[model samples]
Target: MLRARVELRELARDWRSWCKAIAEAAEKTLGSSRVYVFGSAAEGYATGGSDVDVLVVAGRLPRSFRLRGEIKARIEEEAGLPLYHPFEIHLATWKEAEANPIYREAIEKGKIINAQGLDSMKPIGESFGESRGRLPDRSLGQR
Candidate 1:
């Protein structure tokens, strides 16, 4: 039983390291973006079968949904992780993230893995006008 526990710990460590690598790759892929780890991974309850949940909020991204996977692919490639890696990576523009319930939950409950140098950009979901990749100011009563 003790041996099993030790092995589980080692496996968890490996998963965390891999998640960190993916986060780093995402940071490089989307410059000036925020990367967060949510779900079991962020809560430190991940098991061997758990999928790493990552949320990446960027100032800009291709508007088409079809092109989103292309960006994620770049991060996977940079991380040396397979496209089928046990990761649930999400890419969101600041506006999209602000409007998305799942992204909101992740932002609220997740851990920011690439905090260094992330503060140079404006706060997430802040008013930057209706421009692409920017969140509209809800405080102004603009829908």
Candidate 2:
């Protein structure tokens, strides 16, 4: 049980880093895009199996859901996220996010990662349940 918990903590840390990387990559790729993380990852409730929920709010997006998905895939690729990266990405335009109750709620509670560099943002993994001294290196993904 102790070993499982340790692995879970490591996995949670990896997920947080991956989410931050995705946000950074998206900001670089899409100048007007903003990224936010919600759900377990943002709230410090994540476990090894938890999915990092990310919301990408852009200035504009295609009307077709399929096209939006394609754009999201492109962002993930630009982020260099692995095929198995544990992220659940939601894309929306600022207007759409404002109009949707669920999205609005998420925005209110989520951690905005791309508004500025990660250095300015609080350490997400450090708040993961217990205090783990210093944060792990800001490396991109799973080691």
Candidate 1 residue-wise lDDT, 59-111, digit = tens: 78998877898898888888777434577789997788888988877765666
Clashing pairs in 1: none
The best candidate in terms of TM-score:
2
- lDDT of each residue in 57-126, candidate 2, tens digit only: 8776789988987888888898777655567889887678778876666666666675345553443343
lDDT of 2: 0.67
TM-score of each: 0.68, 0.71
Off by over 4 Å in 2: 1-12, 115-117, 122-143
